[model samples]
Target: MAADITVIIPARNAAATIGAALASLVPDRSLIREILVIDDGSSDRTVAVAVECAQRHGLPMEAVSVRLDSAGAARNVGIERASGASIFFLDADDQVMPGSLSLLRAALERQSGAGLAIGASIRRTKDRPDKLKTPDGYSPDKRQNTRRYLRNELWPIAMGSALVAKWAAAHIRFPEAIHLDEDTCYWTALLARADAVTIEAPVLVYHHDEERMARRFITAPRGTFLAIARELDRLATAGVERDALQWRKAWIAQRIARQLIKHRMFADAAGMMRAVRAHKELGGSPKALQYRARIHIGRLTGIGAGASPTTHPAMPQRTLIICHDPPFPPTSGADLRNFGNAVAAAAFGPVCLASVAPWNGDAQPVDHDIHVTALTTDSQRQAASLGWRRIKGEARIPRPALTRLKTLVRDFRPDTIVVEGVALFKLLGPSRPLVRQLILDMHNVESDLADQLPRKSIWRPRFSGVRDLERRAAAICDRIWVCSTSDRERLRTLLSKPVPIDVVPNGIPRAEGIPTVLPQPAVSDGFPVILLVGHLGYEPNIDAAERLARTILPRIRARLPAAKLVLAGRSPKPPVRALAGLDGVGLVDSPDDVRPLLASAHLCVIPLAMGGGTRIKILEAMAWGIPVIASPLAVEGLDLTADEEVLLADSDEGLADMAVGLCSDRARMMRLRARAHDVVWGRFGPRAIRDAVRRGLGRNDAGS
Candidate 1:
């Protein structure tokens, strides 16, 4: 018999992999009508490789290149040109099993008038076992089958795993708008109209990569979720039994709701729960009943699942702020930024801080106006932060806090949510957020910082997930805030979509009763104190402190034996404390104030090997009118200039030399102190933060 199946492979920059995909189809050449390799504007040798491989294998292949930029769009073009009665969709990077396509073709041909044939496929993921994925055989009941496809992962309606009739392909095209999961939507829609038969024959060798946009579950915007829901809604109205369609929609809502609830994103979850409840078919569902009971108990307990929270006159707009550390009496650099940003948000309207506080919990009495919800105890937080729970790139929350958070969201529906950093992002859940405005504050372009860190072989894969975390957070957020233009530029490429990125430089509050000109340190007459200030528990600080004590301090002592090095900050780790045991290094552990250390220290040396963001400790030193010598990376985003406001050095020997040089030169010390203070007071102070917050909130307000 002449070939009757047209295989379509939509490729984009797949030069290295497309040949294997083409070669896999050679055995079924007698059954294939033609092969169309649609190259979607490849800047590589995708077309050339496809053509070369096709000729070598003696397979009928046509190479077509166009600037579609979307795989769905490229597939649609291939569909338009296909001549076969049955259409097989293949990805450029994946391979088809030799006999599976033959089995699939026979299944459709055997089942009289069947429009689709489904086969098993094995998904190959990195460092994981190959698992067989086969669809549950189709039944006469369309609604039941549809529901099963939506609910069960094993019953997948995957593109390469299923072969559909040419008519069905023409009737239902792939959604071109979304960057990911276009195939899922396309298959679901086609499966709705076509009666499919299944065989447990493996067809596709799907290679899965977590970084692939199509496989990523967490980072999509609200528009992407809406697009999926809207299509399902349309399918519900379009002859595929409404019950089946509605059930899938409701199930999707519940899935999203569970994620939202898990993260204590209550308002968003409430909205999703309402959608789930709308599926009248799900009225008696255990999940549905559970959602109903929560809302019922919430209302009785005065936490009403009210409509969107804006009817109250007191709050024109509500905001929710998230932070993993304490937000009161800001001690560390992170603490100061989180607290400052929260205070700024509180000024415009009501603000609620969701503190994922430490195991011991926050000690400060947060008695002020803004409501604080302590979500976890030390045990719960530790349990939630475990490696197993975070493999999927989302932070887990305990069951006990879900309702409390839902109650808060139901009662206090925030119009905007300010996620402090990527540290707590996983706790925000896995799908599109329901809040009107979502803002991400980047203290460090954390993914960039992570890339710079030296990792042990065993820890490499786990730490690599940080990029996914940050990228996914960026994908969901409406806008992003960075500390510097350099950070803004580096971070833009990491986002799944282009969001408005604003550079909100880090700043410190102007201290009271401080003289504009600081007096020269008593270094010439006494021991010279060279300080390195930071949250000593932090990895970068720990490394820098250890290096200074073990290496740099000894070099400095060789020139000037009286010079002493002090590591000052909150929460000094064991390694940092060990620095004090060294000859000239002193450890200031968990100081209530660093002002005394700054006041006495003649020169601050930050000889960091790897760090991120503008060093806030450097700013604190400058604000106290102290001279600083830091690595170039430490001085990033700050207005301080090397050889003028601050001294910059990349090497430990050079840092020690600068410290020794400054000890005797009181005139140079005076000049650096005065200049550095002016830079901080004039460029980096409380006013900078206030202005940035107002601008950020104001833009959202205008848009709303």
Candidate 2:
């Protein structure tokens, strides 16, 4: 008797793409006994198209439409309907390339008791006919499955475009109510059942649907939060050790925080906070709680919430803000972060901006009280292109800037040289060992933060650079100020030398010149205006916006047709601006004034995904006295009593449900708005934090 391999296709209306998917698998008919299409109750002709293609191919295919619509549910349905001994899953819009199926099947057959046989993926790009490679030259090897998948690294294994054994499904099925990472849960369960392998050969050719992919983010709102919660719950119930679960949860929470910051999902960011809080509540250690607290503070305040602020030892005449890109241009996300930091530092002293960008012109600063020093070295352009790698170059650090800094140290004889960015601080040589007091204002937790993100560039060099720079700075600097306590703790672990590390949180000088606006009636128009605000060029901000526009917003609208989202921020990229044109999403560039917008707004949100530090947007909204709903990550750092001042949700339904509740209950909204204003003002107010920074630096008065 020939052994049968079940191919499970969990599809939700792929009328335009299902035929191509089915056609691509024709060669694997010998290995695959049946192609089960779990029609997830798609509104379009996806079922009809799948049925027609199944008949045309003469393959054993069945389309099952169930009341449930999630892909995870659909896959479970197909698993129940599957008759084959071995199982493999394919997306309706994705397909297996030539030779991939055989390789996967062979790998599974070869294993003594393997439940999953993972394979690599090729990006079907029109620009590249062959496989797509990452910038670092690594291929999209899905087969290079993380050890966590088997060890339940973060959660369970990931499904969707991988192959599994039927024996695995009998013991474990995709848990109900998982749409975001259903495959992951399934794979994790399978991994727990038996051993697994990562095949080097390509098994799937996943079509790059930029639009569809972008849309999926919005539709699957809060999926990350739910997945994390479920995974943690499973780990707990499965009797996994508390320490092990805490470690995994810490890694997962950071990953979510980074993605929230990268994508800029302000509203959804609160979900990260929820996850961290939940984890801690679930018997997480005190140390784990501290880590979660730091991330939480960073997400809300855009600075260290729990940590004390950096102190200026004495009044300073000048301060230098260092970065790779020139602050003058203010074009990129990195530049904006550098520029904002530079401006903030200027409040303390005369600020000088320096960069490695190739320049022939002399020092000429623009707009703010900043002096620009640009280096026109031979490989400066190439070096600048390398991003974080520019640290490797000998001349990447502007010598002239250093000379000027040293001269300023002697002539102006400033009391403090606050290095705004870690990159700029790394370029500093031992020449200025005698500077009065050196303050390293770290914006991110360098070493471990990157490694914590999902689908990130897995490289030692990137992490090494962060670690080396931090250690060197700790050795030289008199004091350090990190945005998050998580970063402070990570630095403490990495740096053997003990330096006074003060956590001065980021502050958005409470939007000045606006009237002390009274709370207006909750805008009772059917559309619940969900607002997301940030510097949009950042990865987390962009990802959050795109995900919200494509996934979360759509779900909210489907439930309540009038629900709308205001994508408000400064310097939104073309891709970001395009989101406004999308249904239910209203995008705006840096407004002349955001007071009116805030005054009239009913709900304010922060849904950030990829970032190292706290987001000031969350604090700004709360300060404005708007009822705020946010992700756990968004509320990280601040000592927020959840479900009191602000509402928290981690999934699309959770977010929609929260938003709906806040909108429907006028009294609740008003109470939240009032409480939020008090909470933020009492905790994150500029005056209180400035005083805290002074105290941390051991100064009774900053200039005294």
lDDT (CA) per prediction: 0.69, 0.59
Evaluated against the true structure, the overall lDDT of model 1 is 0.69
lDDT of 1 by residue, 476-595 (tens): 778888888889888877777788888777666323323333445534444678888788877777888888889888988888888788887877878888778888777877787767
Residue 666 of model 2 has an lDDT of 76
- Model 2, 1-704: lDDT tens digits are 25387788877657888898888888777777888888754547987888888789887887765434357667777777889887888888777777666777787788677766776666775555766421121122322233344234332322334577777668576765443445554554554455666666556667664433332333223443445555656744443444554645655554554444334333344455455556544326564455455556665765422112233222223455445555564433345445555544443334566555544546453323456665335453443232344552122454444444455455433345566556665444442473556676676666665554555533334444467667876787788887657667777888878898877665543323222233454455645777777777656677778877887778777777888888777778888988888887887787655666666666775555555322676766777777777778776666588999878888656776787767677788888887887666656554445444554444544322
Ten-residue stretch with the least lDDT total in model 2: 133-142
Residue 685's lDDT within candidate 2 is 56
CA displacement after TM-score superposition, residue 72 of candidate 1 (Å)? 64
TM-score of each: 0.51, 0.47
User: Quick one: best lDDT, which candidate?
Assistant: 1
After superposition on all C-alphas, the RMSD of every candidate to the true structure, in Å, is: 22.8, 24.2
